[model samples]
Target: MPDLVPPMLPATGELADATDPARWAVEFGWEGHRCVAYVRRGRVRLLSSTARSVTGSFPELAVLAEQAPPGGLVLDGTVVALDEAGRPSRGPLLRRTATLTPDAALRAEVPIGYVVTDLLWCDGRRVLELPYRRRRAELEKLALAGPAILVPPSFGLDEAELVVRTAEQYGLDGLHLKRLDVPYQPGRRTRNWLRVPLRRRRQVLLAGWVPAPGRPDRIAAVLLALPGPEGPRYVGRVGIGAADADARTILAAPSGPPPSAVPDGVAEHARWLAPGLAAAVEHRGRTAAGRLALPSWRGLVPDDERDDDLLDMPAAGGSQGGGPVSPDPVRDTGTRARDEARSRPRADAGAEARSRADAEPRSRAGADVHSRADAGARSRTGTDARSGAGPAGTDAAPVPAAGPEQPGTWHGPLSRRLEQHFVYNTLNTIASLVRTDPPRARELLLGFADLSRAADRAEEPTIRLDEELAAVRAYLQIEGTRFGARLSAEIDDPAAAGVDPGAAVPPLSVLAAVRRGVQEEIEPVPGGGAVHVRLVTDPGGPSCRIEIRPADAVRDPFVLFSVPLDVPEGL
Candidate 1:
């Protein structure tokens, strides 16, 4: 498999009202290392935001390679370590990542989990053209779960505020809101996704340091500054929340003369340093004098990681609810749009411009021309069955089904054909691994056999209740190996209710419904939950109903479909 590229990132922005839930989805903003993982065949590759390979740093993430669906899969998420309260803690995660080759003892103490938020590729195909909702559906199909990997729940507009509040209450960083219609753009930062933080944090340059009283060798505090209209200006001092070793390191760095004009009271004891080191400072809010209030050191920003915009000072006298004000919204939007447009692939620029120019003239003549061109394109390629033809052309022929058309048949030209090919290739790949890893190979081979048998009999007109349950259980067990404890199911069998094992029902119907219920209703929950399947028979009627529900309520809107079972005539 080819190497997977690093994921596109979102630009930093303030949160705004999301009045339309259908176009937006929100999730918790995890405070940890941003990592993008690629699972190819049975090997895992993890990359940091800077495209640095960190695969050796987190051995726990190897579970992703085993649990990921066959073929190649690429995921974007954060590597977080949870505190006792189950909330993400950045300190522990940092310590773990800092060690390139952690010992077993350190690994046990600071175990990390990957909180997956987006799916970029699956089954050897790049899914960047699909909308976010579709990508999320494909992600859930993988049933990603385990001690090392997790898929967090997402919420709609109505519950977005609640999610943010809940995150704040749980001591989380904040929330991330993404537009559903936007496609993934590699290496580009667009407004399609916005991040909102619960507290104020900024990266400031380390200007100078104050020597400890009566101990010239030791450091008292570090002076931080933000870029001013003329030069770097004193913002505040970081005196707390750092260990003695950290303080010593900052003070020991090469020093030079103080700034041309030092702020009053700071110059008396401050020793200036060369302007290269930077620190991430967290604080309550800015004081009336525009100085940071109660600032504490978070960590040092790597020398290569500086962004000039991040250091730009906010306009003076601009305050929001007594908190540090954000940059001008109007200016920020214009700058962001320009940057995005400039970053777009140059090859697409000409075509995009031509299309935009052609779309401007909406006259009847233009419409007719566009209709003819679209019809010609469809005639050359085959009309899509999923999206019916427009008024300009007649509907094209439907793609042929692999077998007899069934209720659960999928007719997508690309997907249906790829399904069997992908599965066969996966089995062959696993079989080859048997020489080296017999145990895992054995498990995968058994799962492959069971799944193949179930698929072969799926089109049968009818099957026994016990047979259907067996197939469903086998399938769940296979998927469970991938998800670990994240995916779970409890079935109350019909035999427990005294129903005959020989009772006939539509083949694969119950299994289809249960799988759909879990994917749509259960798996999307942020931290994952359980799914319960119950068999309920009507006392007065001839019909039997299967109930499938998740342990947690779904926040996104969904449509439910009912499938009728085929009963033998005159039974």
Candidate 2:
């Protein structure tokens, strides 16, 4: 057989200096079918984001091929579903294409627009070298005067965010923010684009680690979880483990203090961990689908509350340490713990006092969520919560004012951020099942369905899975190698100084996630292994660099993709 052609790369990392505006151009990202389309000799080939073929389903676009700019070219466009109005309804289109055939009547009535935004091919030329503006210019002139495709509007970074806001408000899919300067990276999901969409947050439990093969001390990250369709969902892991000096100092210490209780499970493997050491965890999001979005450490909570207590909150579950309101995880929860979360004689007064006295602004200083109106978010679960909206465990969505019924719209950016997290974690939870107990995975997912319907939503997973997911993520990483999971995560720790016997960093679960993301390196644990993956964050923040020790495979000194604030100053 002839030499096999290698698959084109799907992930790209540019030169280190990407911060320069001149180094980047920004564009509003559109929401629709994420396909990389190509046309040659009046023939169209529609591909999934993963490059799988799906041209048969989009015959309308195929028929309109005669109108494509007369040459071999490709473009990224959204095949969006439009209602009677020109408005976009993403979910419907995705459903139709994935599940059924769109008949001519339905097709004509509910038109699918190939909204082209970028031009990858020209009549007889390739516009790969041109700046974003020039390539888009080429696309605008394409004589695709057919009912199938239309050129979507474009805007700079300043207006892209506006586009994002408007789209969500108008029932369109989320906006996409792209870097205009980069070349047309075929099949590459470059960081040039940031999908500015809203979603939910799901907090998870951080478990154990699966060290990257070669790297020492420097771990890939750890395993993490949240309750999922399965018992406990394996959202993913931090991957890069206890490498940072400060992170290691904090993580190792929290595993001990005087003497840890040494749970039978933790004692079986991991070589360390006194057991009773309970730290707080913070995950950036959760999805109705049961995935942990962006996750990382908030640091060790006071040993006072059992770790499960931190995991079992009615609202922001599993993020007690260094989460939401700032204070000693131990001391902070102290004043509020006994205050009767459900029945407060002076609840409003207590909320106002805690809101102000704690100085924990409804949101953080630089947090994007800061833009939210306090009255809108702090109203118990929502304004209705303050006015007896339902009990904490009942409301799927509690908004400040009962506006038109919007199913997925959470309150503020924080709420939106949380929503995004829920999606990511839900997926992770499913993945955790696939990784840990491939056989029992179905059973686990069934349980999650039960939880989704149960009134005692306050409940969580019974499984303790830090190490299990780590092994599974390893398998996933190997498969996902073709596509990059570029994660941007941030973890913070406020009261490490108060840590008894120690402080901790991204936690074991974080390390496991990083390890699993890279794939190939399947470590041999004393017990069975797991798969886990975590998040990657952006740049510029105060942090103590925590570098894992020399391990077998990982060679990079430190991959500082996140900003963690939980570690104490020094070892």
Candidate 3:
């Protein structure tokens, strides 16, 4: 079932968004092993993004045969050398993605390579000659291969400057834009995409934080991002001081980019790089002092940040809101739903929890960090699904059924699983907003219903009402999610709906009679009232009987525990 969790395919944001034909196979595949993934003799094979099969290097991709879609196909992709973070940039990858066996420079980094650019046969379709736009559309639909097939993270904004501004403010990379009509040109690079990055977003030689000159009571600024060995060139100071509580928290931290190979010239001033004092700065821009521009210290004095909640603005290309939270919409969604959010008395704990989810969860080897299965399974990045509902609160694209059993190797099932999970989670997430704020939950419900209907109607796996509850709980818990089932239900006879309806029952009939068993457990809180029972015998085969208990609050008890302990898995 874990395998059914989609592979972690890279999002559209990761690429160069090339539209022209000159950059092909040059920038990303500049050197190192270039391999493509394909199916031959019922086995998955690796090929160079340039169409050359280099299957031996990555034998794991070949083992993907059983999970591949039912088709013989080929693809153009890169064997991206990953970094400590799992995913790698061409520039960084060039220095890292290598096999240590013989070439140290080639196998420069650990955790080796991930296959990120698949442009070929996926789901039995030949997308090679298709325009970059169409092929990418299908490619995006491919299942996650761990960190493989990393669709580069992309950002669409009103303008490039605004993107750069926001990235700096958030201390992140700027933007990458691609044309909607470009064609796929393997081994070719075009200007179909644009990247306008913030100066502070790039890697910098950490120096130190400048104290409030003589005040010593305040950290006036963080001395980070230098071009040479001069370390701690003292980038401009951040006047945005924190409250006493925040000050204490900030003062008790470590610095220096969290211990790493200090690169080349950084050691010259490494002595100045003080340990402890991590500053969560929003990279504003580059300062004339060879430092990050007016950076704002974000996590220093956390009050209540709206962006960290499930209720906060969401969906793909979230502009007026924050950009793609991560690669998947689920993780970001879950992060937002974190109950401890907002109301937290201190920002440190909240930041820690959120950061933990954001940074950790290392992608396993042979895993495509960008594969949809892996990425979708772990957490929702809050990015809108290209086919499903837009982040604008709408219905979803029709999707196929999914299950934990299906292989996350192919494009279709993996996507279907993600789509199903997305719908199921969205429907189940409950909070004060869903109950007290029915309007918003209702708005979200409309979209969920649309997605469910679409998935139900498609070849996608059928969703059990119980599974919906579980997904919703898992994904929406942090946000605000509620629970319900037994819509359009009916009892054969109201009188018989009472206790002890006469009938020769099946062994599993006990599952439907949950009120008569397990959930009959919890006692009411201090002064709360006792629970109740409700039975709705559907006009169909599977009739239902439910008990309302303090603990078993769900309309269907199966969601909590598999009664009779015989239900199929993934329900």
| Per-candidate TM-score against the hidden true structure | 0.39, 0.33, 0.33
lDDT of 1 by residue, 1-571 (tens): 3475657777666557455788988776887888889887678889988989999998878888777667778898888875432446666677898888989988767667787888888887888778998887777667675446667666566666555444443445568888888888778887788776655455677788888899987778888886643457788788734455456556566665565446778899898876656666666444546577778776665433333233222221211113222222112110221233332221111223223212222222223233336433112112221123311233322322122223224323222323323342333344344445656655554554444434434433344555566656755665565456777777667558655444444445555545544444456655455544444443221222333333455432121212222232333
Among the numbered candidates, top lDDT falls to 1
TM-score of 3: 0.33
Off by over 4 Å in 1: 200-571
Q: TM-score ranking from best to worst?
A: 1, 2, 3
Off by over 4 Å in 3: 1-35, 47-57, 67-71, 77-118, 121-126, 140-175, 196-474, 477-571
Q: Model 2, clash count? A: 101
RMSD of candidates 1 onward, in order: 27.8, 22.7, 20.1
lDDT of 2: 0.38
**TM-score of candidate 2 to 2 decimals:** 0.33
